[model samples]
Target: MTAGNVVLGLCSYTHDSAAALLVDNVLVGFAEEERLTGDKHTAAFPERAVNWLLDTAGVDPHSVGLVAYNFDGRRYLDALAATEMYAGRDTTRDRAQPRAESFRKVHDRFGSRMADLRDRFRRARVVPVLHHRAHGLYSFASSSYDAAAVLVVDSLGEVQTTTLGSGRRLAGGGCRTTIVEDIADPASLGYAYGAVTEHLGWRRGDEEGTVMALAALGDPTRFRALLREAIPITDGGFSLDPRWFPLRVLAHDYPRVSAGFIAATCPARDPSAQVEAVHADLAAALQERTEQVMVHLARRVRSVTGLRLLCLGGGVAANCVAVGKIVEAGIFDEVHVPPAAGDSGTAIGAALAASLDNTRHLATGVTGRCYLGPAYPRLVLAENPRPGLTAHRPAAPAKHVAMKLAEGHTVGVFSGNLEAGPRALGNRSILASPLLPDVVERLNDTVKFREPFRPFAPVVLASAMADYFTLPQPAPYMSIASGVTDLTRERIPAIVHVNGTARVQTVTADANPFLTEVLTEFAALTGHPVLINTSLNVKGKPICGTPDMALDCLTESGLDALMLEGWWVSKC
Candidate 1:
């Protein structure tokens, strides 16, 4: 944990592009490009993100010695090659591109922007970490566990669909991740679910969570057998039948489904069409299959690795329902999923991987994580004050915010450093009283401007989770859903879903003292230590990253109040 040159990590040119910086084996800063660009899930190179991290950490680019990229450039070309084979085209068609065509592809000589890193900073060495390897490293380095079975399931990562690995701490405070088994492409459960998402009439990557929520309203048994047949279970994982998910027709720009799928089930839904009961049933069936396969995969990893702890990452791990099922199955003694489990998190993973290689130890993990982004040490209102809003500083902002929430007001809170991933995590979140009636309805329809079917989660005090939700452990990142107690269901109807489960986020004082105090004060006033929590942004937009953006959202959305740093603001 002592010495390493400054390392920069990049996960760009794909979904959720981001950058992370490590200095002396410690991750000092990380940010997703989508948060700064105003475009949701932009794949642009994260130049601004890297600059911001370097500036925030006060690190000079000239001093950086290594650059870690989250994808083996050659292996990724192989992944792209499968796309050609899947499309039934000659794999050699794009192998030898002309100089100009190849110029667009290469950023440096070592593969994938290594030259660019050197050009931008100095002559830093660029290393291409395998995509799934970065994910496994991130899980192992970030968790408190010394040894764990790691599972990474995503759409595809350099030909790997699902990876089963084991990670253990080395003698010198370092960690090692070893792949025990992996399921490669052509039989991807991630693609199977993505195909199902597109067929359900929603955007594949952007709207899978909506499908997860819609599943709560449907009957899983209606189409369970059909999907089970389409995706047969294997020894450790599952495989998607080529008949149901023809590679030529799967995950492409158009014709999202195969002819066999149309013959076996109905055609893909139109985007503007209604969410009919059949669609709901299909989503439920798909979700059930995903949960079963994930649980099966975790169980197999536990068996093969003989490890009591599990660390899960990748885009598919973002499914809270499936994650909860894995935990409920008790396949391991503990399960840890990073806050940013998706592609954006690869930046951190890549950096940690390099740090382990550079210094033989991971210096940052097990504590002080997820809130490593930019912060407003000063209130943002005074910089670019928005009209029609009255603001004042309060000595006890948490107490004052709790008072407003107790009065059934929807308040948007923006404080501390930004949470690194998709989940808002209280630092950038909207809060509402869960005991109030129609709070969820108004939050969905008016405040968030989202589908009514979408559900809100409860941010409860950590010690109070057992009193409300039937969770076996603390859910610090809102990554898992658990059963709501009978008393909780009756009292906080706003947070309870149709399936009688709530995605609960348990808060501790160290994570966010103000939110913890607010929840504590709200409990003192309302007798319930819970509030409806969701991202502090409208649908189809990334969460606000700057004070100006937060102020704009405060004016545009139907929120009743605002917590701008330590000040409370409301529309005049």
Candidate 2:
């Protein structure tokens, strides 16, 4: 495709802002704004990201064919107007700033693009793809299944709580996916999940992962009565009882319930140091119930469509724990989850959807690397190494860094094309001995500064994965949670989560030989085939971009050493 025909999908201003550039239906670059902005879940226009892509790819903005925004401001504006009418606000004065504010934000973002465009380009071509279509396309276009049942779940999108689609491969190699069912209004699983997340002491979107993790600690059997009362599953789907959970105007920050259930279900924890067994049990039950419901939904999709393969997208797919259960249920023969599985991935989906009609085509397998962002050459760091940091040439060679890692000192491996997704894989990751039991606690306390219960993933030499975990297939994106045997866990306690499962990313020598050789060599030295692989970043920021960034993270975090390209540095 000529540069002009390329469609750049931008999801800006909304949460998890991102940009995905598509050329002739092939995704070339996709990145989230948070990574560039250095803010966790940063919701802003990804100007730096856009500029970086144009610079890296050497493409001009004017050459872009179409810019696809993932949302329709008109729809949001309609919602805002209706909200004001519902609230009986003074339309002239009180609501003026809000609407003006919205216009200003949108104008400030898109207006620049409008001016930058060639004078000949039509304004109508700058399109706004529907919200659900973006979610559907993200799952369908990135999936390997040609004709599979598709489920897109998020808190809310274009009045759609959940959608069911069928994706099929087209004759000539592309694919066509159609929405078979759209559950709008009340029957939204995403909203039901969000309601509970809000009920817990966490922000709905930001804290859903916490709730998912916390659920394992508690049993929700006692709360089943209350849960059913709160979110009832009907023949259609799930619904939030308007009394307990009310849908407020779009302007409201968090979805509001009548403050009644908050007092009833949520009580202050005792000041004394005591863990609430009941609370833990309640959380456990909720998680179980959620898993059951998701299975039920998956089964419904299978029975309704009779398609065994499934592709999942949206925020709920981020719940790897629930996803593991869904996979283990054996309802679907195979499942694929997109790397960015959230709003950030929508740009890829929407642009792809716009390019195809309803025809069956299997998507290429998930992109394993998260090196989609801009990369800095080693020379950039060599020109100016920060004071006291000696820039030695790559130790031994690119291939020999793996041998050094096998020899036992912790080695930070940053090489090759960086990964294109959220996972660090081997290209942009920190590699250390997983044999150390304290590795997990150390990484969390000294580097991650997050909950110790949070587990690190293991990137094993792919040839050795079958012996460690009963993996159904190669999990390139770290999407599947697999069980590590007691024998394996004893050897590598660092990567195992509390649930006794690890989000494993297996590597093949053919895929990443330099890193794989390192793992193979490490195994020869220690008899363990896995390495402790985490993103090369500080606790709050996205993964590092330059050698300097990686070096700073390594030095500040008190990590032992770094192996960049060929140069190896040990902490002085």
**For every candidate, C-alpha RMSD to the true structure in Å:** 3.7, 5.1
Pick out the ten consecutive residues of candidate 1 with the lowest summed lDDT.
91-100
Candidate 1 stretches greater than 4 Å from native = 1-4, 77-112, 248-251, 365-368
Per-residue lDDT of candidate 2, residues 1-572 (tens digit): 36545667777666777777755455677777766656767777777777776666667776677777776544443334344442454323333445445544554554554444324234325666777788877776666566888887777675566777777776778666777776664355666666666655556666566566666666677677776676666564566665556553345553455566666566533323244565555556666666766666677677767898888887777777777777888888988887777788886666665554321332233344344656555543452355555556753454455565555455676776556556677877877777765777778787766554567888888888987876677776787778887767666666777677888887887777777777777777778788888888866567665566677777778566677765666655
**Which candidate comes out best when scored by TM-score?**
1
lDDT of each: 0.81, 0.66
> Per-residue lDDT of 1-572 in model 1, one digit per residue for the tens?
21246888889876788998888776888888888777889888897788888787676677777888887766534444344444453422332232123322432333535656667766577778888998888877778777899999988776687899899887867678999999876567777887888888887778899999999888988888888988899987888766666542222344545676777666778988888888898889999999999999999999899999999989899899999899889888778888888888888888888778877887564343778788887654552367888888888899999999999899999999888888999999999998888887899888999889999999999988898988888788899988888888678777878877888899999888989999999999999989988998899899988777788889999999789888788888
Give the lowest summed-lDDT range of ten residues in model 2. Answer: 357-366
Model 1 residue 184 CA deviation in Å: 0.4
Q: Which residue ranges in model 2 land beyond 4 Å of their true spot?
A: 1-4, 73-124, 185-187, 192-204, 252-258, 267-282, 357-371, 377-380, 395-411
Among residues 3 or more apart in sequence or in different chains, the pairs in candidate 1 whose N, CA or C atoms overlap within 3 Å are: 108-115
Top-scoring candidate (lDDT): 1
